[model samples]
Target: MISGLDPSGGAGIQADIQAVTALGCHPMPVLSCLTVQDTRNVYNATATDPEIIRQQLECLAADSPIHAIKTGALGNAAVVDVLVEFLAAHPDIPLIADPVIKAAGGGDLADEALIARMKERLFRHAEIITPNGIELTLLGGDEDETRAAHNLLEAGCQSVLATGGHGEGEEIINTLYSHDQEPLYFYIERIGGEYHGTGCTLAASIAAGRASGLSARASIAQAQNYVLRAIRHALKVGNGQPVPDRGIPWET
Candidate 1:
């Protein structure tokens, strides 16, 4: 896992570790940045030195067998460049990237330059890039979700999973777009109330599923189910949004 550190433990590396572990995978967390935030909002963030991030990746790569890589809230373009380099060297490792631009409770996590770098470099190396409707539009540079997904596919991402949590409706329709197959949709009932760490948990769960040898479609389906359950058992740790109960018991 490559992401920022959220002291509140609702999202970022903390959520990633919990989600990955709950899915029966070991999380190799690498911090790309640090944030001062609570369940309500992100007040500020400081990017980790690019060289430090590179060194951590090298050490982890050298010591462990990395099955899959997942990333969230990379603070800047320099961090993205570091990841791009690492991914390029290990072309076979599957990557699941959550293009987190804004916090769930409303705060900017990534700026335009970082988003541009992700689209131009980091995304192409990912096996699947997960984005909410708004993120899809921003990353793909198109107002239309379908068109935006295609734009990403054209830019070399193997697959694009546009999450529907931010969209209007009773059902959350997460759509998966691939170069060789028709778009696949997973319809999940919309759970009421706002929750933090959902995007982080979902991306990590997908990475864990892939690492466990599930097919991309199967991985995505299982991840969605996991997130649903987690949300259903959300933890009200603070006065703001509830933190996802990522450690909740899995249903069959």
Candidate 2:
């Protein structure tokens, strides 16, 4: 997994590790950046040196067999470039990208340049790109959800999971879009209250499932269910938002 480090442990690499482990996969984490944040908001972030990022990825690849790759909160274009190069070298490794534009609490995690770079480079290598309503709009550059998702697909992403967490309704409707296939909708009851790291956990769970050899559709279903359960058992570690209990056993 390539992501930032969140000290609060509600999200980022911390959440990715917990989610992957809970799903019975070993997380090979490569830190792309570091954030100074809490459960409430991200105050600041610093991108890891691009060379260091490359070295870490190289070391991990040489040491273990990477089944899948998941990315979140890449702080800058340089980090995105590194990932693009890595993905180009290993095209067989599936990529699950959570286009984290802002924190769940409230703060910009990625700027316009990085977002552009993701679309122009990083996203084409992705097997699936997961983005919330707001992120979908921003990344796809269209206000209409369907158009936005389609825009991403046209840009070369194999699939797009446009999450409806930021939408208004009794149920959260997450739609999966791919070329020539009927859009699949997963209707989840909207759980009340603010929660952090839900996106990271969901993406990581999907990566774990893919690594375990599940089909993309099956992996998405299992991941959604896992995240729902984790949210139901959220931990109120800070005064701001509850953190999903990603450490909960998978069988539960």
Candidate 3:
């Protein structure tokens, strides 16, 4: 299931839908927030009612057996609270969270209070959390990436995938950290030009892989390859940043 809905079809649940479908998984969308956005940036976002959120989740949970859950920009603390409680009741389902604190165009997505509560509650329930450099710093309240990842792991996430898109490097370095295993690094040549919604695509793809019964490690690897191909075929749909061509197949 997915929370955030993006009219742009560039990120949030829209992107999640495309990524999951591409990976041969059925998607069940549950909106926590709705946004007015294009390929450029988010103009405005409105939070869905917490009761409505619970209703949707309950309806889906009752009718269908959800394999995995992918969550994006939850609008406020109320939605976070509802989601946290719902996630707690379904502990075995893999949850992939893309910690979207800010948009690609530098728009503020979440407030300080929401972020804090998410770390305390939502993070503990996630199977794995995917955060870029800026988000990691904000969530961890520290500049050190390794330290921040460890902080998240200690907070309760089974694993953390710290993406390197915002970091300074000639080659992008994505790291996966788990409690009992050594850190695994995925190196990909940095694709030139800024693209929107890579994080959402990555997290959604990972969730899809997990839903298909792949282990976290295997899912991370598949997700990375999928995102890389999507980036390679990215489209300049609007005046601002290009969006990943999620409809394109990985092989072609």
Candidate 4:
């Protein structure tokens, strides 16, 4: 299930559904925030009522086995707490959370309270969290990404995969750190253009992989490979950013 919303279908739950469907998995969505946004940036976020959150989840549970869950943007602290409560109630489900702090066009989507809420509540429930370098620094403080992962693990998460998209280089490195093993580093040539819904795409792809019965590491590997291909075949949408041709065949 995806947590973020999109009016333009370029990001958030819409993009997540596209990615999940393309990867041959069923998508059940639960929105955390309904955002006014496009390829450019987010103007504002309106959170789903916390009380209604559990109702949607109950429906999702009744319908499917929901092999995996992917969350895109949790707009506020309250929504995050709701997520944590939901996870606590269903500890058996695996979750892939994309810790989105800022939009691609440089707009802040999460508030100050949002971060603290995640650490105190939601971080503990997630099976895997994907954060960018900026977020890593915020979560890690003075520690490195490796240290940050361990720190996050201490909070109760099983793994952390920090993405280095804002770095300067030809290659983009995404490092996965887990409590039970050494870090796994995956690399891909950085796609030069701005893209919409990439975080949603990657996280949903991971959920899809895991839903197909692949292990966590295997899911990350296949998801990484999938994102590279999606970027390579991306389509220019709107004036601001390229969106992956989510309809493209992602699995061979």
Candidate 5:
């Protein structure tokens, strides 16, 4: 996993780790950014040094046997460039890039340049890139949901999953697109309350499924179902966004 550390434990790398573990796969974490935030929006974020990022990834790659990689909040262009080097070193590993450009509570996570790097570098190389509505709007090439994913696929990513949570819809729509194939859409009833960290859970769950021997499509389905339960069992913490229940069984 690659992301900022969220002290509230409801989002970012902490959330990714919890979700991956809940799905029963060993999580290999890579810290890309550090932030101070609660269940609400982020307060402040500091991107980790590029050299330190490289060293940590080198250490992990040399010492461990990792199956799949999940990326979250990568801070800036330089950090993303460093991560891109790490990705090049492990071409065989499946990567899930969760493009977290901003916080749910209106805090900016990355600047325009960083987002551009992510769209061009990380998204293009990963097995899958999961972006919510707003990110899709920005990264989505022509500002159209359907077009955004096609643009991403054209950019060389193996697949893209665009979540509908932040869109204007009666029901949330998750559309999965791949190279040389038409997009397949999945619909889920929208949970009524404010929510956060569901994106981290969804991506990491997919990573866990991939690590556990499921293909990208199968893993996506399984991860969707699991996210439903996690949302259904969401617990309110800090009077802000609803925290997803990490205790839910992802295998179901």
Candidate 6:
């Protein structure tokens, strides 16, 4: 299941649905917010009522066994509280959190209080938290990638996938860090030009792979490969950044 909805079809649950379906799993999207935006920029995001969000989650949980959950761009503290309560009830399920703090066009997605609450409440329940370099720095209050990721780990996150896409470099370095294990790195040549929804796509793909019974490491590898391919076939649907082509065929 997903936590947010994006009308743009560039990120959030729209990207989650496409990525999950393309990876061969059914997507159960629970709307947390209604965003007013396009591929260009975000004007505003109105979070759904906490009771309605709670009802949506309860209905889905009662009807079917949720194998995994991928959450993106939670809009407020109320939604965070609702999600925390639900996560507490279902502790065994695998959760992949893509901490969507801001939009690609530089609009705030979540307020400071909501972010703090998420780090405190949601990070512990998540199996893995995927944060791009920028988000990691913001989450950890540290500029260094390794130190920032360590901060999150100390705060109770089991594993951290710190994506280097937002950093300035010739190569994109994605590092997976877990307790007592050396960080595993996946390197890919940096693709030129900006692309939308890469983070959401990657996180949801990982969730799909994990739900289908792949190990955490295996799912990370598969998700990175899938995102790279999607970027390679990215679509320039709007005037701004190109959105990833999530439906592109993957070579088996």
RMSD of each: 1.1, 1.1, 1.5, 1.7, 1.5, 1.2
- Of models 4 and 5, which has the larger TM-score? 5
- Model 5 per-residue lDDT tens digits across residues 1-252: 888898888988888888888888788788888898998899899999989989989999899888888888888899989988888988888988998888999899999999889877877679889998788878876777788778777777788899877766567789998877788888877776667899988999899999888988888888888888888998878878988888866555
Candidate 1 vs 4: which has more lDDT: 1
Clashing pairs in 2: none
Candidate 6 at 77: error in angstroms? 1.0
Candidate 3's C-alpha lDDT? 0.86
TM-score of each model, in listed order: 0.97, 0.97, 0.95, 0.93, 0.94, 0.96
lDDT of 6 at 133: 83
Q: Give the per-residue lDDT of model 3 (tens digit) for 98-168.
A: 98988888777788887987898888888889999999877876789888888888877778899988766
Task: Give one digit per residue, the lDDT tens place, for model 2 in 151-223.
Answer: 9999998999998777777888999999999899988888876689999998999999999999998898899
After superposing candidate 1, which stretches have Cα over 4 Å from the reference? none
Per-residue lDDT for 1-252 in model 1, tens only? 999999999999999999999999999889988999999999999899999999999999999999999999998999999999999899999999999899876789998899889988988899999999889998888999999999999998989999998877899999999998899999998997778889899999999999999988889989999999999999999989998899987754
What is the lDDT of every predicted structure here? 0.92, 0.92, 0.86, 0.81, 0.85, 0.88
Model 4 segments more than 4 A misplaced: none
Full candidate order by TM-score, most accurate first = 2, 1, 6, 3, 5, 4
Q: C-alpha displacement of 69 in model 1, angstroms?
A: 0.2
The worst-scoring run of ten residues by lDDT in candidate 4 lies at: 140-149
Give the runs in model 6 whose Cα sits over 4 Å from its true position: none
Report how far residue 68 has shifted in candidate 6, in Å.
Answer: 0.3
Model 5: lowest-lDDT 10 consecutive positions: 164-173
Residues 1-252, model 6: lDDT tens digits: 655666778888889988899898999888888888788777899888989889989999999989999999888988888998999999889999999898888888899898999898988889999999889999988999899999999999999999888876888889999999899998887887778888999899999999999999889888888998899888888888889999987654
Alpha carbon deviation, residue 139, candidate 6 (Å): 0.5
